[model samples]
Target: MRVLVCDDEPLARDRMRRMLERIPATLCVGEAENGQELLERVPSVYPDIILLDIRMPGMDGLQAASRLSESDSPPAIIFCTAYDEHAIAAFKVNAVDYLLKPVRQEDLEKALSKAGRVNKAQMLAVRRETGVAQPEQANAKEREYISVRSRKGIDLIAVADVRYFLADQKYVTVRHSQGETLLDETLKELETEFGDRFLRVHRNALVALSYIEALEHKGNQFYLRIQGVEERLAVSRRHASSVKKLLQSL
Candidate 1:
């Protein structure tokens, strides 16, 4: 597992780095002087876990942790603080564990052992505590691909390639860059998971916002013109107003 050490004090970071070396299974991938540095390095380092210090110069560990938690994929946090008074607050921020500073080797080892490598499921559970539903939280990241079975084998369809999903009786037709394919998932589930990129136009259809060309109102009916695909999808009267609002925002 890749671990990131974050502390303003050079000596504190050195001690933690040395202790981490003793555990050959884990690698100290990066180190940051303060919370600001930690945020800057996080995207590049992509550490599995971060050992964060509570009090920092530009930004505090708690503030940094909050911002990190909002990320599509946030690393697990283990806060190291000198003040015991911050223990309750640490847990409130969904930290894996809090170690009192001058952190002890035993405590550090214990915390590391608790969460060897946090997965999306673990992160979803933590996000649930903050009132986001576990199901939606699990897919906070715009899913890069959709797995669909083809005549040859399974195809990994890029989400960006998909123009729209039109539901049939039991299956959904995925109209994409190459053509169309069948998907087993429901339109409602796809609407919730990819809400940022997709907009539900009808009861059975969800179209990609990026591919939307224009909205037309003809003979008291509304239709959506999509990019690449010449076929226009009907927009239900119930959803036409909401779709217009979304399109206007873009």
Candidate 2:
């Protein structure tokens, strides 16, 4: 399997590399010093798995993992961290395995063994929870398409074709280029699955990054307007800070 080792510390990265060599005769496609580099390399190499560190410069592993999980064919993720606090959260994000550092050969083997058993769709599901690795590149090839179940059976929706997703009780309402469809998934789950393409506007809603036209505030309430959609989405006051940060970056 092609693998990418991501860590900020040079020694940590080197140690992981050495451990990887002993586990199996897998190709070390490349190594990333931080999350940003991981995002840049993932698309080009399409590694089968990524050995991610929880702490790093620029973007932390958790944040990076959140982004990488949105790719069409995202690599299996195994958290290699020095801390144990993130173990529960890691599982919540659908991480295959969580290995605390110094990483042991036994632990790495177990993680890989489990990874081998997972199917492609399961891996894709994990990626969806973590979010997309990077912003949609204008020239980059579109990876996977989402199939939304409709009255007409399954309606295939391109990732780029979606505008936003609204949480409705147990199901999520997907707003696409043509129209909306309901799926049996929560907004939080969808946030984990399609994080790369969508951003959380409120506790119960996520909006596609591409479809967001602007953010407007009236009185104490904030709202997000989509390009084609006429209705404005309410942005919760609690998440306003994060929303502003995202908008400023864009």
Candidate 3:
């Protein structure tokens, strides 16, 4: 894997270069002191990944990442920062992983391994075969991830991975394959955005239509049974009829 190290500190850049040398099948193509210099070298070096630092003299890492996101085949970005406060902002710019400094060898290897799994060449080949959309059109609609703020950091969950969303007071709990995460977005806003795929089961809950296993009735209350989860979600009387109709359609 071709990696470009970008940091303002000379020692920091040298340390990254040395680490990359130790990793097999990895090359440190170039090093840049700031974001502007990083951008200048990117076209020529054509790196697969960039180990970026957040704070610099000019054109910070976030700004540089945003600019790179516009490219058709942008290199995957792994942010190496000392501050944890910028975690939210870093993932907002679609960073692959945010590693706090001084970064560990294991963490760097894991991040690179994760980034390598996304095969851009294979994606383009499939797109061409299916005639789904032009490369520019496909790239334009790439923001399918939902960013959730948590105590650890911002976690990017793909919309397809979600099973249901349950509203509890100010926050919404997003139930997905990897378990649940708290989201700041309201249930109403989520319904407005993803109404087509998500069904309104109650006033406070929206379930993914794809994961609807069955609807169960116990006493006077109706409950929804999800495919993978054992816990059944309560179905309100108001939306029960609509839910049944949706089930029949499926």
Report the Cα RMSD per candidate.
12.4, 14.6, 18.3
Which one wins on TM-score?
3
Which consecutive 10 residues in model 3 have the weakest lDDT in total? 131-140
Give the alpha carbon lDDT tens digit for every residue of 106-199 in model 1.
8998888775535334444443343322234326466789999888999998886788999999899999989999999987788778755566
Global CA lDDT computed for model 1: 0.77
Cα displacement (Å) at residue 56, model 2? 1.1
**lDDT of model number 2:** 0.71
The digit string of per-residue lDDT tens for model 2 on 92-148 reads 666889998888888888887776445244443543444423223323333467676
Ordered by TM-score, highest first, the candidates read 3, 1, 2
- Which is superior by TM-score, 2 or 3? 3
Write the residue-wise lDDT of candidate 3 on 6-66 in tens digits.
9999999999898887775466778999999999988756566899999999999999999
- Give the TM-score of each candidate: 0.49, 0.48, 0.50
